[model samples]
Target: MSTTTTLEAPNTGTWDGGNEPMKASYGKLMMWFFLLSDAFTFGAFLIVYGLARHKHMPYTGKADDFTFSTEWWPIPEKVYNAFPGLHGMDLPLAFVALMTMILILSSVTMVLAVEAGNRMDKNDVQKWLLWTILFGATFLGCQAWEWTHFITGTEEGMLLADGTRIFGANLTMNQYGPPLFADLFFFITGFHGTHVLSGVVLLIMIFINTVNGVYHKRGHYEMVEKVGLYWHFVDLVWVFVFTFFYLI
Candidate 1:
């Protein structure tokens, strides 16, 4: 007697002919293509951010207050308030650090989940996927906190150096460092957050399947790998955010 085995190209309806030498499943190949396009989107965004920084920002503080070669935009600390009730704390970057660690950790957990799936260890897969989901959610919570703190300063009214105030207003060009800065911040981060939010939902779906023995019945877990690719992409985007938004 002879037996035959077949491999399914995951997350796609296409039947594999088993002769295409590229060999990866449809899900993974699509992830690679999506990442390529995503890279271009981020490049465009960073390019614009660079352009914004080149134009000298209006400075309220005396020249001595300037840092980073005396030509940088307002110190991120002065512009973005991260710690609540820590007036003049000079610690705006700390929250971003937390956000970064959470995302990176989530990526690590995702890899673990993929490994567990490869080993056909259903219990381990479930465990690692839960951890991945938790870390991703924590990052989202931190981002939500960061956004809230930045939008609402301690004074209740947005106050200028000379005591002028704007209240209940999204920081505009005249209000915040630059209108474009605020706009780009919202667009990029919001887009990224929405991705995280979707990843969480998909993870939940996969978790439920694992619990219900979907992979067990199918005899494999390529679905987990498909989702892991998306999880990693979200983490990669935050690397850009940390570099461009916080570092330089």
Candidate 2:
């Protein structure tokens, strides 16, 4: 007697999006997807910036010797050489360096907040989150100052070919080098700044919730982790922006 056994159908429930992949929660996975998409957007913007900069050769001279010219790309150091208190000084990248430090420190505080969240320490979470917010606000203030200086420009100003004397950078003209430089600067930096602002708002929300014991009642701090991911991403993007837009 030959008995044939029938094979049962494979279980489809696990594959029906019912189970979390890689042991990650649905919310965490969704956050990753969103971040991946955002990365692509930022990557495209940076790539375009790189290609455009490559197409136009940057000035290969001293910052002091550099002149305003649309024909060639302006050196970043020459363009961003204004200091706050010490006006008229040729401190290239000083203010930007400070901004970078402030942002990085904010990222550090964010990490601490996430760690505290993971440990279920609500007090520490609130403390670190507040620090992160303060640092982020400081960074934004620095950026505002930088923008003001960039717009106000040097007292000497640049004389255009058409007998127009412009002080700083605007959409139509740039005292630095090419108008394209200023355009990309505003768009890219402005986009990043908006992200920072959003992150700060989110942090404030999380801080309020923590103070009110919302996450404590829920028994998990996953919300903090999600915002932490976003904060870290913003900080990481700035590093690249500083490298490409400033140092390069």
Candidate 3:
């Protein structure tokens, strides 16, 4: 008598095995997921800004009349024309453009650091990481300076016909056309600056670990690659922020 045996099929529902979903490590995959969610948040913020700008933009026949009108939005070029050390010169978007370049350079250094890690070159990794940190710090410093300048109003601020002198920007008031403009500027740029600061801190910790030969002992520089991914993401987000806030 011949008997047939039944076979059991493999379970593909739950991922219980040691396989990575996309060949990415657990930490890197999680980082990617977090970045994806964060991208949605930024997108929402930018969309709201666009809608607000269109709704509140000046449509009056006289452009000069709507300079300080609450119903109109301030012209970005006029507001951000001041530059460091060249106070009287009208250099619109110069400082912000420099900040963007600094961030891009930092991303390049991050790439070099990741490459060094792949080659197991600890010294080169440290050098590149240090450069990246310096660039990040410089960018943060520039932001702080810009914020201070914005808070300190110009000599002749937006003076209204009602004799209400709007000096500087705050949560409730702004020397600019509308309070919403300042509000969005503070919220969006402040959020991005916070991310840059956090990335710097993370890079510092990773730098310490690299110095201590942690990854070297592990025989892989996956940590550096992971942090590089984060750094690149931050840089990419800044590009969008710059285009939305400054360029557009």
Q: Tell me, by TM-score, which candidate is best.
A: 2
Off by over 4 Å in 2: 1-12, 61-64
- Rank the models by TM-score, top first: 2, 3, 1
lDDT of 3 by residue, 25-121 (tens): 8888888999999899889889989998988856454644435556677767767878899978878899998999999999999999999999999
- lDDT of the structure predicted as candidate 3: 0.88
> What residue pairs are clashing in model 3?
none
Q: Residues 1-248, candidate 2, lDDT per residue (tens digit)?
A: 65998897656687775565589888888888998998888898899899889999767777577787777897787788887899889888999999999999999999999999999999999999999999999999999999998887888787778998778898888887778888889889999999999999999999999999999999999999999999999999999999999998
Q: Write the per-residue lDDT of candidate 1 for residues 120-177, one digit (tens) a residue.
A: 9999999999999899888888878777755564454445567767542254642345
lDDT of 1: 0.76
TM-score of each: 0.80, 0.91, 0.89
Q: Candidate 2: lDDT of 142? A: 92
Model 2 global lDDT (CA atoms, 0 to 1): 0.90
